[model samples]
Each structure stands twice: as structure tokens, then as C-alpha cells.
Target: MEHNLSKHISGKFNQDLENVRNHVLAMGGLVEQQLNSALDAVSANDSEQARQVEKDDYKVNAMEVSIDEECTRIIAKRQPAASDLRLVVAIAKTIADLERIGDEARRIAQVALDSFSKEQQDLLVMIDNMGRQVSKMLHDVLDAFARMDVEAAFKVHKEDAKVDREYEALIRQIMTYMMEDPRSIPKIMALVWSVRSLERIGDRCQNIAEYVIYFVKGKDIRHISQEDIEKDILKL
Candidate 1:
């Protein structure tokens, strides 16, 4: 009878953990959609689409709150140890990153409402490319989390450098345009803000990748050198 009760408890705990994992994935999906929509708004310079993206941010915020409460409840009820504890901790941290990413997306949408001339449209192409790259990184990191694949997470981490380079290149191009034509300053400044938000979204995606590694290896690799991270990944 005691063994049967122990099995029942363990099964219940597993179910609860799975439930939380599913919720986190669902939240991630919503965040990804919000990001893509915001990027679309920027590409089209559509105020209505931007406003809709801003409104969608509330749903992301609500999911963050709900997921956090569920994690706290699981901790209090199950008193999980070891891997189970790590799972909950990683989920909580990832949710926080996702919420911040959503905020960045909303900022990008706000920038989209600004008017730009036809000459400035060429500049937007670069921003659109950057957004697409970061969107792919976000999608890949979420997949890594779902599969618990540390290798995939590491790939996403490495991809962040590319996003950073793209941002730098865009900045240089914008500065050149600003120097050549002072009249475009206002619109160029708005594009700068939008790209900055896109750059931040890339950073947030990297954070999610780090959480994926933590969930798989039970190791915290934040603030460490790439060399050290590579070494750790090799061990697994």
C-alpha cells in the first residue's frame, strides 16, 4: 500500500510538471506571434497593425503572470528537488525573458507609426532583415527548449553575434545617411529606435537559449566566456 501511494504521488508530480511545461510553450508561441506581427508593422509602416501589436502585449503580460503563479504553486505543493526543481526555475526565468522580448516588440511597433520618405525606405530594408534574423533565432530557441537540445541552444547563442553585426552595420549606414542629408534626421532617428529594439530582442533570445542549456545540463552559464560554454557543452 505504501509503494502504491508513492507511485501515485510521483505520477501526479510528473503530471503537474508537464502541465507547467505545456503552459510555458503556449506562452512562448504567443510571444513569437507578437514579435512577428510587430516586425510586419514596421515593414509596412502601418499604424493600425502597430496598435494591434501593442494591444497583444497585454496577453503576453498576463501569460507571464499566470505561468509564474503556477510555478510558485508547484513549488509549494510538490516540494520538488533536483531535476524537477531545475525545470521550474528554468521555466520561470525563460518566461521573464519572453516578457521582456514582448516589451521590445511593442517598442518596435510604436516606432513604426513614424512617417518616413521614399528615400528612407531603403534604410528600412536593413531593419527588416535584422528583424527576420532575430525572429528565426527566437523560433529556434523555443524549439530547443521543447526538445531539451543543448546543442541547438548553443547554435542560437552563436547566432546572436550575427544579429549584433547586423545592428552595427545598420547604424553605420544610418549615420552615413544622416551626414549626407540632414533633412532625414527625424525619420532616421525613428529607424534607429526600431533597430535598437530589434537588437534587444536578439539579446532576449540569447537569454532564452541560456535557460535551455541550464534546463538540460543543470548548469548556469550566464556571464561566462564562449570558450567556457563550449567546454561545458562538450561534457554533455
Candidate 2:
């Protein structure tokens, strides 16, 4: 976490890097808000809040583009090397993941605009439970990013498995419902898509966590098993 960002000869260069990093954290906060609001909309059946989440997606997209442009500008102008370059790369990747998480939140919000049956309410409850876990994961990863806490990032990475299990179990439940009443397929499909989005958000959170580990440890841990990460890379 002890990044030498202030070591550059040009104070402006240091400030520029700090600004871009702060913007990424700001973007993360916005995405987290969108996710929480989307989940609340579905749970409370508030179309108004859902529509608001839909409307605010553009903000996330805009931040991504802006931060990307800034990062590009930094590389072009300052020609950052070593850890500074890694910082920029990590910010780029993190923002991309945050934007996609926003998209997933929007997808989840769409389910709120439509009505569900009494029986289908159970499925929505399942979705909400999974959504909350994913939301917590997202929040934790962002906090990890802000503090450059590698251990926190690893914790979030391991948490994705729980979300996956929840997603798989929900899918099976939905499939069973569809089998009981063929007529419920269309409605069940909507729930299917929402749950899938939640699962994907969990994945994006894991990706951000990887970026954190990469930034701090300068190690590329993608495609590596958690056991391997702990036993090999993290043990260092």
C-alpha cells in the first residue's frame, strides 16, 4: 500500500495520477449505489427506484470513458513506468469492471418494472438474497481498492464461490418451477436473467480483486486457483 506516487519530479504528474486514482474510487462508489438501489427496487417493488437506476447507468458509463481518457493521457504525457504504470493499468481494468457491474445492476432493475405472481415472489426473494451478498462483495472490493488492501481483495475473491453456489441453487429452483408449470417459463426466464446478472456481478467483483493483488504484489493471479494463490503467490 505504500505506493511512491509522490516521488515524481513533477508535482503535476503526481497530482494527475492521484486524481485519476481518486476518480476510480468515486466511480466505484457510484456503481455501488446503483447496485444497492436496484436491489432495493426489486425487493420493495418500486418501479420508480428501478427507473432511476436505469437512468443513472449513463453516469457510470461516462465515468469509465473519462477515467480511461485520463489514463491514456497520463501514459502519453508522463510515460509512467514500473509501479506508476501498473497503477494506471489497474485503474483502467477496475473501471471497466465497474461499468459492467453497473450494466448488471440495470439488468436487475428491469425485473422490478414488471409484476410477479405470489408464487414468483419466492424467486424474487431468492434473487434479493443473492443480490445482497453480491452487493456486499462489491462494496468490500471497492474498499479494498481504495486502501490497496491485498488481503481484503483476496477475501472478496474467495467470497465469489458462495455467490456462485447461490446462483446455481436458484437456477435449479427456477428450473423446477418451470417443470411444474410450463406456463411459467416466460416469467421464470426474467428471474433467470436477473440471477445470471447477479452471478456475473460477483465475477466482476472477483476480477477487481485480482487487479488489486496485481497492483500491489505485481503478480498476475488470473486463472489461478485460490489455493494456489494462497500457497504460492500470497505466501510470498
Candidate 3:
């Protein structure tokens, strides 16, 4: 959790950096709340709660724009170098992913607003379980980002594969459901899209994990395999 921000001579500069970092964490907290509420709506089948989640998405979007502007202002005014630059860059990227995660959460919430049959409810249960997995991943990655913990980031990075496996299995089961009951196609399509959104959220969490690694290690590890990350980056 400790960083080099205080090493700077100007106390104002240190405060500037600290302010931006805290804002990112606050934004992360809001995004986490949004995801949790969306999952709750799905599990409870509450259209009112789902609509509330939909309404709250604008808050997440606003935070992204505000943080982005702050980062730009820091770069222009402070002209930071080395680790400071990386921190700002990583944070800018992190907020973008978090906003997308918020969007996906809203999409997942939309599922509760639609009517599902008993069999479809079973599929939704599976989707809810998968969403819980992704939500945990998002939670862990955000914790990693807050601490600038590379090991924690790596751990969360590894969890995405489990989400992907669950996604594939659910897709197979859902596709079978669609093929057997063509009458349910319309509603089932919505479920399929929601599951897909959950999968995308998993990917975004992984991307944020990568940003954490980049910030701590000063390495751009995108498109690198997990084995390569552990072998080439993590070990160093």
C-alpha cells in the first residue's frame, strides 16, 4: 500500500498524487457496489432493484470522466516521470475497465426485468453463480489495484480461466435449451447476452489485474501467457 508519492519535495505535488489515487479507489468502491446490487437483483428476481442498478450506471460513467480529466491535469501540470507517470497511466486505464465492468453489471441486471420459465430460471441460477465468480474476481482485482500488490494481481489474473470455463459450459447448456425449446428463443436470447456480459466482465477484471502488474513492475504484460508472466515477469 505504501508508495513513493511522499518522496517528492513539494507537499502540494504529493497531495495532488494522493488525491487522484484516493479518487480512483472511491470510484472502484462505487463500481463494486453496482456489481453487487446487480447480482442481488438477479438472484432475487427483483425488477425494482434491477431498475435502480440501471439508474446508478450514470454515476459510474461520471466518475470515469472526472478521473480521466484529473489524470490529464496531473500530466499537464506536474509533468511527472518514471513511477509517477506509470501510476497515473495505470489508473487511467483501470478506471476505463471499471466503467466497462459497470456497463456489464447493468446488462446483467437487465435479465431480472424479463420473465423466465422454470427451466430458464435454472439457467439463470447458473448465470448467477457465474456472475458471483466474476464479481469475486472484480473485487480481488480492485483490492490488488488499491494495494499495488503484484502478487495479488497475478492471483486474480489466474482466476479468469475458471470464469471462462464456466462461461463455455453455460453457453453449451443454454444453446441446448434454445435448440430444444424454440418457443423460448426470445427470452433465452436475453439470457445468452447477459452471460456473455458476465464473461466480458471477467476479461475486464483480468485487464485491470494486468494494469496493477504494469504499475508495480513497470512491465507491459498484455497478450502474454500466464506461464510467461510467472516465468518472465513475476519471478523478476
Candidate 4:
């Protein structure tokens, strides 16, 4: 038998869905703060700042858990359809991306702690720039989501190129250092992890941006290569 909700229950269900949206936005803010603090710690060479980043990791983790629980409750109790269902699904996915970004920030802090002596200013500069790019991507994607702006989301998808180029540059430098001085291999490896973590943060940001597009248009803009999206879809 198909279950039918009474009018009052349906209204309450809609309210519950809105709560999920709010919770997702809250989680996005927390992760973005962590990313900013991680960059600040790296740039400033402040151990105390790095420690603060580590401490804030729990807040992000908690947000992830809470959002996940809310999503489960909505799906079970509300059985929302159409856009409401889409919103809940998007919120769940966005929280996952934000949580992953938080994990990457924590990883960066750990890399800094392990790799820094007094300070590695050159490496710190690169990491700060990388974090900044990732932060901007996340911020714009979140804005795109709140507004349901597909164009803004697509822009984020394109902006990922800068992060990719930076990651490749870091890889080259790492390989060169390893080849020239075998003694630097251990430190170079640490740098490699830090840089890769930053790049993965960018990827998670892109993933969230795509979610905005999907929720708005219900398109699986993912897995469709850039060329296809531009030449195939946009052209049509």
C-alpha cells in the first residue's frame, strides 16, 4: 500500500528539508574556516596556529556527522520527492565533500608540523598559494549552491586548471630535488603529500560545485569530460 502523509505532516516534512539546507550551509562555513586557518598557519610559520587547525578538525567532523543524521531522518520520515529530494541528496553529498576538505586541511597541518624546522619559507609560500586557490574554489561553489547558479558552478569547474598546474609544478620540483640530492628524499616526500593533499582539496571543491549544477538542473555534469561539456553540451 502507498503511504499518504496528512497535510500537517507534509508541511512539517517540508520544514525538515529546509533544516537540512541550513545544516549543509553551516558545515560548508566550518570547512572553509578550517581551510583558511590551515593556510594562515602555513604562511605565518606559527605552530600555535597549526595546533588550532588541528583542534578545529573535530568541529568539521561533528558537522559531517550531524548533517548525515539529518539527511537520514529526512529520507526516512519525509519521503520527499522532486526538488525536495534533490535538495536533500545534494546536501548529503555537499557535506561529504566539506568533510573531505577538512580532512585534507588536517593533513596539511600534520605535513607542516613534520616538515618544518624553524620554517620552510619557500615551501610554505607554495602551500599557502595552493590553499588560497582551493579556498576560493570552495567559496564560489558554496555561493553558487546557495543561489543555484549553474554558471558560477561551471566557472569553478574551469578554475580547477590553476590548481592542477600548480600541483604539476610542485611534482617537478620534488623530482628535481630528489634527483639532485638523495639526502632530501624524505623531506621531498613530505612535501609531495602536502601538495597532493592540497590538490585533492581542490578536487573536492570541484565535486561540490558540480553538485550545485546537478541539484539545479539534474544533470550529471560529472564524468562528462570538459571537452564534451563545452563542445557537446554547451554547443547544443
lDDT (tens digit, per residue) of candidate 4 on 1-236: 11121221356576786667777888888888888887777676667878888988999899889889989988887787766677778888989889989988887776546545443456667767777888899998888776666777778888888999999997887687678778777876767887898899889878887877666666678889887766754442
Question: Which ten-residue region of model 1 has the weakest summed lDDT?
Answer: 1-10
Give the TM-score ranking, best first.
Answer: 2, 3, 1, 4
Per-residue CA lDDT of model 2 for 86-148, tens digit only, reads: 889999999999999999999999899999899989989989999999999999999888878
Query: Candidate 4 versus the native: TM-score?
Result: 0.87
lDDT of 3 by residue, 42-68 (tens): 888999999999999999999999999
Assess each prediction's global lDDT (C-alpha) against the native.
0.85, 0.91, 0.88, 0.77
Candidate 3: the clashing residue pairs are none
TM-score of each: 0.92, 0.95, 0.95, 0.87
Of 3 and 4, the candidate ranking higher by lDDT: 3
Report clashes for each candidate as comma-separated counts.
Answer: 0, 0, 0, 0
How do all the candidates rank in terms of lDDT, highest first?
Answer: 2, 3, 1, 4
Off by over 4 Å in 1: 1-10
For model 3, what is the error of residue 49's alpha carbon versus the real structure, in angstroms, after optimal superposition?
A: 0.4
Scored by lDDT, model 3 comes in at 0.88
Per lDDT, the best of the predicted structures is 2
Clashing pairs in 4: none
